[model samples]
Target: MRGGNQMSQLMKQAQKMQEDLAAAQEEVALMKAEATAGGGMVRLVMGAGHQVETLEINPDVVDPQDLEMLQDLLTAAFNDAASQLDQMTQERMAEVAGGGLGLPGF
Candidate 1:
């Protein structure tokens, strides 16, 4: 009987953890991060899931004479946003995994 009671308690704890993880995932989905480059001539927005949501380019940055520079700015903005998104994901997943355990698929 005592063993049965312990098992039941453990099962309950596992279920609660599962619920907490699900809630955390939902919160992450609703979060976003932004990055900018080229003195704010370009901006990138990334979701918590590491997906690019938006890109903004300043009209003043438009210059046929300097298209390569504009392209570089866009790339920098995107890479910055992606780096931030990776960091956010790691932090959140660590919080979810209860200290990151370096779990698989986390």
Candidate 2:
């Protein structure tokens, strides 16, 4: 019947979309973003899931007389990386949704 054929076609399209979304999620999870502060004395690396991957501190920046400065730089770098990660997730989700109903997950 015509209705049955249309339903089958729609199901196939849905399955394809699901597959594409899964691929996109996988790719996004692997993406990385970095943020630095204090003239690059502190660097923060983040993954798409907003997880901190690494923290690097330049030895030259470490001064016993200015430990507070180093701490501030580390804090700023981590905050920046977290904000950037949120932006990245939003962008990736938009790309995967392709302007669809904006579902929470795909």
Using TM-score as the measure, the top candidate is 1
Each candidate structure's TM-score, on Cα atoms with residue i matched to residue i, is 0.79, 0.77
Candidate 1: segments with Cα more than 4 A from true spot: 48-51, 99-106
lDDT of 1 by residue, 9-102 (tens): 7777677778778887787778788989889989889886677898888999989998999999988888888787677767876776783323
Q: What count of clashes does model 2 give?
A: 0
Question: How many Å off is the CA of 86 in candidate 1?
Answer: 2.2
Writing each residue's lDDT as its tens digit, candidate 2 over 1-106 gives 9999878877776787788788878877888889999888888899866788898999999999999999899889988988887788778778767845334574
TM-score of 2: 0.77
